[model samples]
Target chain A: MIRSIFIKETQLLLKDKGTYFWLFVLPILFIVMFSSIFGNAGTTTYTIRYFDADGTKESRQFMDTLAQIKGFELAADNEKSLADQIQAVRDGKQTSLLVIPQGYSQRLLGKGAAEVELHRDAAEDAAAAPVAAVLDSVTKQYQEHKLRVALKGTGQSQTGIDALLTAPIQVKDIKENVAKANPVTQIVPGYTVMFVFFIMITMIHNFLRDRDSGMVSRLKGTPLKAHQYLIGMWLPNMMVVLVQSTVLLTFGFIVYGLHLGDLFAVAAVIISLSICATGIGLMLSVLVNSVNTGVAIVQIIAMGGAIVGGLWFPYELLPKAVQWIGLFTPQYWAQRGMQDVMIRGAHLDGVWMTILILLAFGLAGLAVATASFNRFAAKAKN
Target chain B: MKHVLEVADVVKRYGSKTALDQVDVHVKEGSCFGLLGPNGAGKSTLMKLMTGILQADSGMIRAFGMDTRHQMSEIRQRVGYVPQEITLYEKLSAVQNLKFFGEMYGVNGAELKQRIAHVLEQVGLSDRANEAVETYSGGMKRRINLAAALLHQPQLIILDEPTVGIDPQSRNHIFEMIRGLKKEGLTLVYSTHYMEEVEALCDDIAIIDHGSVIAQGSLHEILEQHADQAVYVESDYITEPPQLSSIKRASARGRGWVLESEQPLHTLRDLSQLFAEAGARVHALELVKPSLDRVFLKLTGTALRD
Candidate 1:
């Protein structure tokens, strides 16, 4: 009996064009659009326009130092005037502009200090702050060089002067336990988990359709038990969710070269997530009184869970309080589990806790849904 | 005859409203029992209770001698129910719908296939068995709904207003099919607000109103006990109406006169002589027997449809 119901449900869904659009087409569209926008996972670089007005050796050396900084790209030409460059910055074209004033080298040599003017748009603060800090470091190095030369000329040994110029303490950064935060890796799983939740709408709609059409009461009149009926209705939708997750994951791997660690663990997380979605769909079908209300409630859950669960952005970047709320949504755990496997390259051993939590959510949802369904059926009899 | 179904003092309540109030009914084996009532008169509720789709709050319902509450699964296996609404999967074909419902009753293999084919043929939809129910006409869908109920070949079939919203041809087709089932010795519980349908198809009936049974017995007995006997007369060239105390009531009816009375024979004899004396020519005169519709109206003080 369960198998029969499952087959019937699957066939019904297959005949519905809307289900095809949501299950296959919409997820692919979302994945393609979001991946293209956030596909680059490497280090980001900023371009700076520089005018070398100081035609001296010290200014040339300072320009060379700026070129060697790790994430700074310099323009090929100094042809644009200072006014033009500053206008470009204000117009949002140029991120930052640097001008080495004439006689800068002479001033540094004579008074040990020379200021180079830096122009930037305040609105581009995210890009402008990094450029300003790098320029400051470069000028300070030039001032140190001038002092070292002056001290060497005063009859200190060259090696001793070089040693004295170097600071007693040096700080070097060694990255530990950090993986590259690839936006593609984060987005594919995040949106996949979020969109899988939308499948609940279709599930609930089918269940309610059966109820409104009187099929449920007819089935109830049969020899089939309630538990068997519920299982029959639920299993097919859960399978659809699982298939949808597989399709999205495969699309991620083929197009974006996403690396998923431990294929078994990935499957486990996805299956658990599908179970949770199915349970939620069942619960909604029994709880809501009408189709319109069911659709409204499902939209709220899907969109709200997507936003709060960090499908649109990284959860780590959200406020501490919001992060606490994210933990309450199923998307958080499912997305985190995917991230653990795909981004962190952790195996099943690392994601077991998240998988367990997802299963618990599924079980709780199923329990509540079953109880609500029993009550709804009883009420329907009355 | 053995009783196939018995409802004793069954009471069902929904929150503040009582849907079924102390209802009692007994359906004999291999007999067509008509549940007659107006809309919301608890006919559907009573049928659902017998099918074990619902539980009574304060009574006992037994189907095939098994308790409906505890042995519902067993009871359901022997009872096929056709709900008032079209309960079929409209997206699926006739064969698919029948096959699905057939399997739910644990019918499978060659037996299930044969039964599906037989029911489709029985409902006169064999030629269109592969078409989706949504594409079929309303009458055709109603027929298929009946066909689905007949798939398992249960001993007792419960039909709740099965002919509603169907064409006359299809309604007659359903009536014929139901009569054929009765001849085959399958007990049936037919619920409807149509008095003609009950008169045509049912052997025994129970008229319910306000959640209780107002009348129940053999169809002939109920009609005899409650319905009035009257003689209808059609005449022309009458200047004054006839005056006879034996005539309980006399009124013009469509270019004719109808005289109703308990003693219809004496009333008819007196009306003929009176029309002769009044110099009126009798075009037609006949005695009309009591009908179930009149019986229902007399007992409920309202029309069957009202």
Candidate 2:
């Protein structure tokens, strides 16, 4: 009997063309849409300015080389005023200014070191880091070349020894990647929550339809108890939700390289969430008399849940009071589970609290649904 | 042997509005009992109650001797219900809808397939089984809907307004199916607002109105009380409407006017005199008796429509 019902429900879902499209096609479409929107464009531009005071071939060569790196746009001191030129570079892109002091070559030749001034726009200090790294690399290479020439002037076959001094006396250092937040990545969790929200809304209406069409009453009319009927309707939708979520997660991995850790825990959280959503749907069915009414109710709830649970924006960014309100949303719990699994690399044991919260939601929803269905018998005849 | 259904003093109310007021009804083994009533007469409500789809505010109901309230599933297993509205999956084929409902009823394996085929044939829907219900005509869908209920080979069939809106062909097909089921000894509780259906098929009828059973008896017996008030006259047909003062009721039927009068001979003589005085042609005329239609009209002042 259970198998027959399962088959029947499966066939029913299959026969519904609209559901098939929404369940399978929609998430893939969203993935493609967001991926295109957040295409791999590399990091932000980091501007570096060259203040060449020493007119030697070595310094000019060094200056010319450092400015050639990607995300590095330099200002030559000969064509424009040094401070003004540096200011222009900063204003044009990111103001990361580098100065080559006078007698810098003589100081290097005498086995002495002089400071090269690096000026930066305070607002763009982070953007200057990568550009500084580029300057450091090029300057280090120039210093070694200068050292090799100096050793050649001294004669006495010091070329081999000069080559051996790989570490230059002045090696400018650079190591930073100025990364910017992409709207697409930021909205992934929101989009996922939106998908789950839309699905739950759809399932909720189907649940109520059983009541409106007298399907539930008819099922109850049979030997099946209320709980069984509830389970039958709910399990089919829950299974669909699970399949849809899995497909979305797969897309996340393949498309954006979303590292969803702990497969078992992720699947468990999803299944638990689907169960909870099913319970919510059942409760809706119990409260509403018609499919449209149930849909309207779910729509309102889904919108509220989506907004509060960070489907549109992260709860962390919201005001403290709003965040408190967001915590009440089931979407919040679901999003929390997903973010934890993805961002924190947490195991199932770690997300157990989220799973429990979602389970509590499901249980509460189921309780309400049962209460409402218990009254179905009374109103059915009319 | 146990009776298929017994509804005893079931009282149902919609808020303070009484929908089924202490209504007692029964369908026995292999009997086609008609539940006849006018609109707002609670025929559908009574059917819902009988099928265990609705619970009574008070009183008791039993289907196959099991309490309907607690043992609805057992009762549902024994009976098939075709609701007043064509509550079907319109996107699916007739056979598909049947399969869905059949599965719900736990019919599986070759037995389910055989049952589907048998019912399709029984309802004269074999030719249209694969067609989507939306593509079907009004009558065809109703036939398929009935076929769905019959797929499980239920012991008791409850058809509420099964023929309400259908073509003559479909209506005739449904009546024939009911008759065929009767021959096979399947008990049925047929509810409709149409009195003629009760006259044609029911062994007995319980006429309801205002949430109560106003009358209940065999069709012949129910018609017997109002028999004297009706008189049917068959004529080669008068050229115009015939005036008979003693006619407490009259309706223009085919090839004649059925006149219900207290004095049939006098009315007949008066008809002849009037035709002679007007120089109207009258080939023949005879007084006939009352049908269930007249009996129903007499009992219910308003016609059976909102």
Candidate 3:
């Protein structure tokens, strides 16, 4: 009977175009959209629109030096006056504007400071901060050069000058998971985990349809047991979620070159997540009285879990409290497990906690569904 | 004859409303037992109880000599229930729906396939078995709905308002199917509000109203016991009802008046003489047969359709 119901439900799902849209198509669309938007975050160039009022040799040299830095593209605004560019900044038309004032050469030659005016919108601080940091770095380099030249005039050796130039404290930067820390890694798994919960909606719909249409009552008259029916209805959805996740993850891999670290570990997470999602689906299918209520609850679970569980972004980036709460959601564990394997190069042993937590959640949901099965069946319209 | 089903004083209540109050019905083996009642008269409740879809508040329902409360699993294997609603999955093909139901009843493999084919042929939908039910007409869908229950070849088949909203051709097809099942010595419990349906198909019947069984017996016995005897007369000469001493009650029927009496023959004679004395032509005059409609009106004082 379970096999029969599974086959019937599978056929029904195949014929339903809405299941495809919600499970496969919509998740892939989200993955593609987010990947396209943020895939090249590391290489994205921040532009510095500037009016070189001084246009002198020194000002041009300064501008060229700043332009030499990577990820800081310089665009000379020769068409607009300095005042107009500053007004554009004030009016929020531009994030920031740079102006090379007159006497810029004299200040560098003299003992005075060579200053550049940077007019920026404070509201656009994130966009303007990198540009300011670039300018400050260039200023420090000039200062070091001045000091080196002065030491040369005092007849110090080159080795002594080099020793003096070294800073007392140095910051060393080390990149970890360099190959796996890309946007595709975040987005592919994030959307996949988020949409896995959407199977709840399909489950709710199928179960409620049976109840309201008198199918449940009719089936109750059969020799099929209640537990048999519940398991039969549940297994097909679990299989669907498995297939749905596989299709979505495969799309991520083929289209965006998403790295899946360990195939076995990924499979384990997929299996556990499928069980977890469909188990909750079974519980909600019997627990809710109406399809509208079930759908509303599904939205809260899928979308809300997506946000808090860090399926929409990196878990570390969320607020501390939300991160604490996200630990309670199976989606969080699933996403974390995927990232641990795909991003950190972990294997089955590393993701065991995730697998266990997900399985526990799935089992809990199944238990609840089992306990409520009789009441749910009783409510069916005879 | 052996009793296939026996319901003893079943009382079912939905909150404060009594859907079935001390309802009792019994079905003999190899018989078509009709549960006749108006809408909301608890025919469905009784049917559900017999199938174990519902538990009676206070009663003992034994099917095939097994208590429903304990031996439901065994009974379910022998009894097929066709719910009042068309409950087949519309998105699936007729063959697919039948296969699902067949397997649910523990029929499988080659046996399920063959049974599906048999039921499809029985319902006259063998050619359209592969098409989705949603694409079929209402009557065709109903045929498939009934076909689903027959997949298991149960000894007793319970049909709840199965012919409702069906075309005449499909209804005839269903009637033929019921008659065929009865020929095979299978017991059937058919519930409906249509008087003619009961009169045409049922050998034994129980008339229920307001959740109580008012009459139960063979077709002849119930009519002889509760149905009124009367004479229907139509005459152009007699403008008002003919005043006769033997006629007890006069009520308008189609184009005539049904005059009730202790002796329908005497009333008919008196009516004929009165019309003759008026020097008027008599269009029709005959003894009224005892009908389920008159029986219901006599028992409950409310029309069946009401």
Best-fitting candidate, measured by TM-score? 3
For candidate 3, the TM-score of chain A alone relative to the native chain A: 0.99
**In candidate 2, which residue pairs get closer than 3 Å at backbone N, Cα or C atoms, i.e. clash?**
A90-A95, A133-A174, A136-A172, A222-B73, A223-B73, B231-B260, B232-B288
Q: Please identify model 2 stretches exceeding 4 Å from their true place.
A: A39-42, A46-190, A289-326, A376-382, B1-8, B26-28, B59-73, B127-131, B231-259, B263-280
iRMSD per prediction, in order: 0.7, 2.5, 0.6
TM-score of chain B of each: 0.95, 0.83, 0.98
Best-fitting candidate, scored by DockQ = 3
Give DockQ for candidates 1 onward, in order. 0.75, 0.33, 0.92
**After superposition, candidate 3 runs with Cα above 4 Å error:** none
Pitting candidate 2 against candidate 3, the one with the higher TM-score is 3
Candidate 2 chain B, poorest ten consecutive residues by summed lDDT: B231-240
DockQ-based class of model 3: high
The digit string of per-residue lDDT tens for model 2 on B57-157 reads 99998888899878777778888888876767676788777877888788877898899989888888888888878898999988887887887788999
Kindly provide the TM-score of model 3 when superposed on the true structure, using C-alpha atoms: 0.98
TM-score of 1: 0.91
lDDT of 3 by residue, A1-382 (tens): 8899889988998999999999998998898888889988978999989888787999999989999998888987778877888888999999998888989989988889989988889999998999889988988989899999999999999999999999999999899999777999989999999999999999999999999998999988888889989988999899989999899889989998889999999999999999999999999999999999999999999999999999998999999999999999988999999999999999999999999999999999999999999999989987
Docking class for model 1 is medium
